[model samples]
Target: MGFIDQLKTEYRVGGIVQRLIFWNIGLFIIPMILFSILKLGSVDIGIFDWTNPFSDDFFSLSSNPVDLLWKPWSVLGYAFLHSGFMHVLFNMLTLYFAGRLFLTFFTQKQLFGLYVLSAIFAGLVYILGYNLLPLLVGQTAKMTGASAAIMAILVATAVYAPYYEVRLMLIGTVKLWHIALVFIVLDLIYAPLDNSGGHIAHLAGDLFGFIYIKLLQSGSDLTKGVSGTIDFFANLFKSRKSAPFKKVHRNTTPPVRNSAVKPKDVTQKQIDEILDKISQSGYDSLTKEEKDFLFKVSK
Candidate 1:
């Protein structure tokens, strides 16, 4: 396959998290390229200009509530736009780590919903902080990045499985909550130093993650709203079809069995037993054989 074709294939099967990363990277690069070309042609469109905070840019959430009236999409669009190379790099890396961890015990729908909801929540909180806080009053700021959504995934995973162990280079093994706490502490410490809006958004994401998991534990799923909205839009774009009329026919041929095909060794009973063990304790409670069996079954 060609390079572009390979990338398309990867995006098709890389799961929701990888698709999200691709989206962020694409939005960042495509706008920059379009902006450069437009500038060269002396075309000054306010929509493509990221430097002007009050301009009609498609991304970057502004602190001014009045600006939101014209750029409502920025609430979620900002998460897909990055300020710089390092900004995208670290955010994408954390997304990969936290996203994979979150998916271990959750569904893809939940992850995507949490990401979207958290970003919107964080953007609103950022704007509110800039507006009401004594230290940030009268300050206007525009923020863009995936840090808030990434933090939501990370914090959600830690809350769901606090004791989950992850080994780091030179630091050995540590619990997931340990890593989550460190990030939260860093955000709190840096909120007053610089990038205060970004830090506030991160904290907002952390709060949303905790709330999402707590509600989930109480048998309330927040992702259902996201899923339903997605389904509605998807169906709106889909072409309707009618069932074809068919006639039933009788056949006298007997069924044939292939001797070459072997029956599966793993049965539903065995799978249920393993799942029960995991539920009663944790994934670590499974034996080597059980883990191997589960892995193979998953494949």
Candidate 2:
């Protein structure tokens, strides 16, 4: 196969992470091409530029009203902008693996929520660290990368499937928790020394991911709020559906049956039986009869 064909086959946009990587690379390429054609070589369309958080150019509510409106989007945009080939490669690889791991156990809605929240926290940490730290010594530096968000997904996956194992190129299978520990340690130790802002952002994202998973175990999902926000805008643009509040009344009475059908009550014993089956044989192992019974009872 030719080089272009090989590239297309390997990296064709399909899953969420793959599509995101494609979009990022496309954005970077399109701008460069446009600039080249228009002879505007000096223009920089890169979303995240290294600017002092305290500087007038930084997105801050106190600094400028216009910038404040734009600040929230920067959190998302920064994830797609990379300074070099290696930067994007590393970030995309991390994203692909972490994202795949996350999707193995989470719904797309949950993954989307995790990504957005992680990116937001990462940006917040970057801003706070750059602005408040004396270690910066008033040096104006801007941070941008998807590493923080990728780290968040990685942490969340570890929390969700701690026993899941993956084989490395040289090493055999390794538990997910071991990988999580290594990242946590690296972030904690190196965060204060090199790329402090990025490290801080990563930690912040990781915290959110971990907390989100823990909350989910209790039958509460943080992603529900994010999904609601998406639904609000989607409903606004699309045609409105009839509200559930409307009442419908039937005028005619139905004929009575000779024998009355009794509603089947699910007993505690039956529930225990199902639970035991699930524990021993797994959810997918349940027979059709068992599944139907469980489904009806669940309702």
Clashes of each: 0, 1
Question: Which runs in model 2 stand beyond 4 Å of their true positions?
Answer: 1-13, 40-70, 240-299
Candidate 1 lowest-lDDT run of ten: 49-58
Best by lDDT: 1
Q: Residue 226 of model 1: what lDDT?
A: 99
Provide the overall lDDT of each model, using Cα atoms, as 2-decimal numbers.
0.85, 0.69
> TM-score of the candidate numbered 2?
0.65
For candidate 1, write residues 1-299 as lDDT tens digits: 47885676456446788889999888777767777777788886654454432223446799988888988999998988887778889999999999999989997778999999999999999999999999899998888898999999999999999999999899999999999999999999999999999999999999999999999999998989998899887766653553356588887998677676545533556766876676445456689998898667555
| Best-performing candidate as measured by TM-score | 1
Model 2 lDDT tens row, 1-299: 47775455334324456666776677556655665654555656454332221112333222122344657566566765665567768888888888888878876667777887788777776766766778754555555567777888899999989999989878899999899889889989998789777778888888888888898998989888888998888878654664747788885988676454443333546655875666444455578987787666555
- What count of clashes does model 2 give? 1
